[model samples]
Structure formats: C-alpha cells, structure tokens
Target: MKLTKRLHSCVQLEKDGRVLVIDPGAFSEPDAGLGADALLVTHEHPDHFDEGRLRAALDANPAAALWTLRSVAERLAPAYPGRVHTVGHGDAFTAAGFDVQVHGELHAVIHPDIPRITNVGYLVEGSLFHPGDALTVPGVPVETLMVPVHAPWNKVSEVIDYLREVGPRRAIDIHDVYLADIARPIYDTALGNLGRTDHGRLAAGEATEV
Candidate 1:
C-alpha cells in the first residue's frame, strides 16, 4: 500500500487501486481532494475532522463510505444516511481492499479541565499504523508508523519516544503545526537513523516508499 500525508491530519492510502483517506480535516487545505473509496475518521475535532469536508468529499465521490467511531455517528448520522459504519476500539473491519483493525483512545489533553473525548486510530493491513490524535502506540509492531509531529500537546521528545516504542521500519510525521518548521533540523538530527519525509517543509505532496 502507498501511504502519503495530505493536508494536516489527512492521509491518503492506496493499495491495488483502492484508496482510503483518513482524517481529512484540521488545518488542511480547503481544495485538497482525497480520492478515497472509504473515509476513516478518528474523532470530531476540527483538526481531525470536518463534517462539511467529509460531506463534500462524499458528494464528490458517492461511492466512498465513512468508517468512524460511535461518537461521530451521534453527530453526523442525521446528515449522512446509509454511509456511516460505526466501529470501536479493538474492532476490525475490511475497507479499501485491506483488513483494517481499529485501536487507540481519545484526545484527553485538548482541554485539561474536562474529560477526554472519544478517539481512535487505524492499523491498515497489519503493516501500517495511523494513530490519529492518540498518543498511545499499538501493542503489535508495525512496518510504518504515521504520527502527528506538531500539535498543541506534543513535544519533540514525545514524538521520538513514540517512534522508539512503535519501532517501525519507517516513520512519517503528519498533522504537524504549519509554523514548526524550525523543528525539522532538530528532528532530523535527532532521528538520524530513523526515516523522515524529505518533502519540502509543510508541503504535503511528497512521499517516501518502503
């Protein structure tokens, strides 16, 4: 499968001509199009999700379906009929021609005062793991790890630690803040042996193959 980062938290995964788009929201390009056969969302936050964008994508590609958590259903079910499938942590479902496993928890750090909202990540084909907004790593090893590099709560050390735990053959940093380009040199220097995307800083068009 080919995995590439799109706008913000969005990622495009292609395998055998099937495309699965994940988290096409949060600090993303308004015009970016994720040619997805299925859309996988982790949460409902603006950065991780945008109902309008999902709706627009669905409108543009009627064949695409949405695989999301129950929290999303409560909010989006009224608008999206016959297109939403709810899955929870530990659940596995097939989409985009691969056997996908759903795991991880919610983004609790967003607001220190309140409890965390429900969230989850995806393990695609048992080789690629997209943690969405969750900070937790998968129990099983993965070939490639797609993680958020820059966020309000994530630090460089935290990102590095997560990478070490996952121990993937490669790592791609996505969902990074647009202004944190200064960390590139630092991150590259620190992650000397581990893989990092060589695309121009903040540009989401480039991809590295494993």
Candidate 2:
C-alpha cells in the first residue's frame, strides 16, 4: 500500500487504484479527502471531522462513501443515504478494497471538567493502525502505526509509552499540527530514542510504501 500523509491527522492510502482517506478535517487541506473511494472520520472534533470538506468530497464522487461513529454519521448520513455508514468498536468492513477494523471508544480526555466524546481508530488492511486522537492499542499485531505525535490531551511521556506498548515494526507521525517547529526536534529525539521501533515522520504530501 502507498501511504501519503496529509496535514494534521488526515492520511490517504492507495492500493489497486483505490484511495481511502481518514480524518480529512479542518486543519487539513480544504480538499483533503477529495477523490477518495471512501473516507473515515475518527470523531466529531473539528480537527478530525470537517463536514464541509467531507460533503464536498462525497459530492465530487457520487460513488464515494463515508464511515464514522454516530455523532458524525448523523450529520452527513441524511444527505448521502446509503453512502454514509455508522460504525463503532468491534466492527469490521471493507472500504475501497482495504479491510478495516474499528477500534477505540472515546477521545483522550482534555481535562477533568471536559467531557470525553466518541472516537474510533482504524486498523487498515490488518497492517497499519491509525488511532485517531487517542493512544489506543488495537490488541492485534500491526505492521505500521500512525502515532499522534502531539496533542492537548497527551504529553511526550504518554506518547512514548504508547509506542512502547504497541511495538509495531515501524511508526510514522500524525496529529502534529500544533507542535511548534522549534520543539519538533525535541519530540523527534524523544520518540526516536525511546519509542523502541523504526519511527519517523513524513512532510505533508510525502508518500512512502508500507
């Protein structure tokens, strides 16, 4: 499979001429999920689920579809009919020719007073796992793990520990939109030295074979 990293948490995967996009949110390019055969949203957070972008993508390709949890699915399903599907933990489906297993239940808590919301990760093709906004361990073997390098709900210690726990053969960074450029090397050094796996990141629009 060919994996292309988009800004923030969005990623596009291609195999056998089919494209599946995940988390094409507001922080990502406005047209981030366009041309996808299918799209997956992890949660309702604006950074993870931009309705306008998703609607536009669906409009551009009549055959395209979206899979997401109830909170997000309800917002678009009414318009798309059979094209929008609701999914949750323990669910498995094939999208754009890639096998996807849904994992995780809620987003990481931002604070003691802030309420947590639904969030689901996707283990695609049984090889790569993207845990959206949480440090969810899929409990199944993974070849490549998409690490949310930085976020409000987590710190460097948690990220390193999550990496140690999942122990994939390789890892690439995602959900790093707010990490300042000057502090990037700090994260790089920490995760690279302590993540204990082949870990790295790709610039926006960069692609690598997995």
Candidate 3:
C-alpha cells in the first residue's frame, strides 16, 4: 500500500484501487484530495475531526464511507445514513479489505464524557497501527505505525515509550503542532540509525510505500 500525508493529521492510505483517509481535520490542505474509500475518525476533537472537511470529502466522493467512534457517528449518522458506522472500544470491523481493531481511552479526559467517545487506535490488517492521539501502544503486531508526535498534552518521552512498545517495521510521524520546530530534528536524531525507522519527515503531499 502507499501512504500520503496531508496538512495537519490527515493521511491517505491507498492500495489496489481504493484510498482510506484518516483524520481529515480542519487545517488540512484543500487540493490534496486522495479520493478516499473510507474515512476513519479516532475522536470528535477539532484537530481529529472536521465537519466542514468531512462534508467536502463526502461531496467529492459520494461513495466514501465513514468509520469512526460512536461520538462522531451519533452526530453524523442521522444525516449521512448508512454511510457512517459507529464503533467503540474493543470493536472490530472490516473496510476496504482490511481488518480493523479499535481500542484506547479518551485522551481529552472530559468529565462524565460519553464513554463510547473514547480514543481509538486501529490495527489495520495486522500490518499498520494508527493510534489517533492515543499515545499508548495496543500490543498488536504493527508493520507500520502512523504516530502523533506533537500535542499540547503529549511529550517526547511518551512518544519514545510508545515506539518501544509497538516496534513497527516502519513508522510515519503525525499530529504535530506548528511552531514547535523540534519534531524534525528530534525524529531524525532518534530514529536515523534504526533499521526499522523510515527516517523521513511525513510532510503534506509526501507519499511513501509501506
């Protein structure tokens, strides 16, 4: 499969004749469409889910389905009909020929929050793991991992710990905040010599094979 990074946290994973988009957030680049088959939203947070973008994407690709946590499903299912699937922690489902396992606690930690709105990490076809803002590892075999490198609540140490646990054959960094100006150097120095590390910045419009 081929993976391409869009602005902010959006990623397009393509294989065969389909594309799967993950977290097409508000700040994503407009013309960088990948003609998605399904969209995966890990949470309803602004940076992880954007209503406007989702609408645009759906308009662009009328056949695209949306696989997301219950919190997101509740909001969109009413309008989107069969296009939305509501998943929760421990749920397992398939889309676009890949097996998907969802797990993780809500990182935002809102009080009395919708229990089903918890954070989610997807184990895709037992090959790739996309832990959308859920910094912890899910203890599954991951050939490639799309990792979030920067957030107001996360740190470098946490990211290192996660990498050690997942032990993916290759990795792509994501969810970075602008102005930190530290991810590139840190990522280069930390994973540069590792046999498994991709050792490249996952900037918008860039594509890589996995």
Candidate 4:
C-alpha cells in the first residue's frame, strides 16, 4: 500500500490499483479528494469533510462511493443515493479494495462546555490505522498509525500516552496544520523521544510505505 500525506487531516491511500481517500477537508487542497476510487469521512467537521470536494469526486467518477458516519452521510447520501453509505463504530466494509474496520464513537472533547459529536477511525487492511480527529485505540495490532500530532483538543502528553497505548510499530503525523514550522522541532523531539516507537512526520505530498 502507498500512503500519501495531504494537507491537514486528509490522506490518500492507494492499494491494488484502487485509490481510497480519507478526510479531504476544506483545509486540504481543493482537489484532495479528486480521482479517488472511494472516500471516507471520519466526521462532519468542515476541516475533515468538505462537501464540494466530495461532490466533485463523485461527479467525476460515478462508480466511486463514500463511507462515513451519519452526520456526514446525511449531507451527501440524499444526492448520491446508494453511493453514499452511512457507517458507524463496529462497521466493517471494503472500500477501493481495502478492508476497513470502523472504531470509536465520539470526537474527543474540545472543551467541557462544547457538545461532543460523532467520530470514527479507520483500521485499513488490518495494518494501517487512521484515527481521524481522536486518539482512538483500535485494540488491534497496527503496523502503521496516522497520528494526530497536534490539535486544539489534545496536548502533547495525551498524544504521547495515546501513541504508547495504541502501540503501532511506526506512526506518521497528521492533523498537524496547527503546528507552526518553528515549533515542529519541539514536537519532533518530544514525540520521537517519548513515544518510544518509530515516529515520523511526512510533509504534505510525501509518500511512504508501511
């Protein structure tokens, strides 16, 4: 499988000549979801689920489909009909030739006053796991983890602990648009040293094998 890191929270995964995209949010490139054989949205947050980009992908490729939670599915299902499927935690499905296991139910609390919303993580092919906006433990061995290195809802200590708990052989940073360039070194050292596992950060558009 080939993993391509996209801007912000979106990522493009290719396997067996099929393409599967996750997130494709407003923070990513407008064409981030384009040319995908399938799409998966973890939540309805604008930074993780951009309706226009999804519409474009589906319009351009009629055979392509989308799998996501209710909030996101509701927005696109009406227009796409059977192509947009509503999925939640414990759901297992194959998208673009990749077997995906959905895990997690609620987004991490951003604040005590803010209401929590639905969220799901994807464990792809039993090897790679992408936990959208949350630090969800898939409760299975993972070869590669797409870790959210920086976010408003989480701190480095919590992220460090999450990484240790999930116990992926290796992890690549995601959900990191909030981390400024100068501050990157700070994260790099902290996660690399404290994570006690293989930790990596891929620049937007970089590709790596797991």
Ranked by lDDT, top first: 2, 4, 1, 3
Candidate 1's residue-wise lDDT over 77-126, tens digit each? 67778788998889999886878999887773866877788889899899
Compose the digit string of candidate 4's lDDT tens values, residues 107-166: 999999999999999999999999998889989999999999999899999999998999
Clashes of each: 1, 0, 0, 0
Q: List the residue pairs that clash in candidate 2.
A: none
Q: How well is each residue in 1-210 modelled by candidate 3, as lDDT tens digits?
A: 888888777788888878888888776766434377788888888877887777777778878788998778888888788999988778898877657888776664334544434778777767878888777577777888877776665666666667777788777778865525654786556654542455455767888887
For model 4 the local lDDT of residue 76 reads: 86
Model 4 C-alpha lDDT versus the unseen true structure: 0.93
Q: Residue 107 deviation, candidate 2, in Å? A: 0.7
Task: Give per-residue lDDT, candidate 4, residue 95.
Answer: 91
What TM-score, over all chains together, does every model reach?
0.88, 0.99, 0.86, 0.99
**Candidate 4 Cα misplacement greater than 4 A, ranges:** none
Candidate 1 least-lDDT 10 residues: 193-202
In model 2, where do residues sit more than 4 Å from their true spots?
Answer: none
RMSD of each: 2.8, 0.5, 3.2, 0.6
lDDT of each: 0.75, 0.96, 0.74, 0.93
Q: What is the lDDT of residue 96 in candidate 3?
A: 72
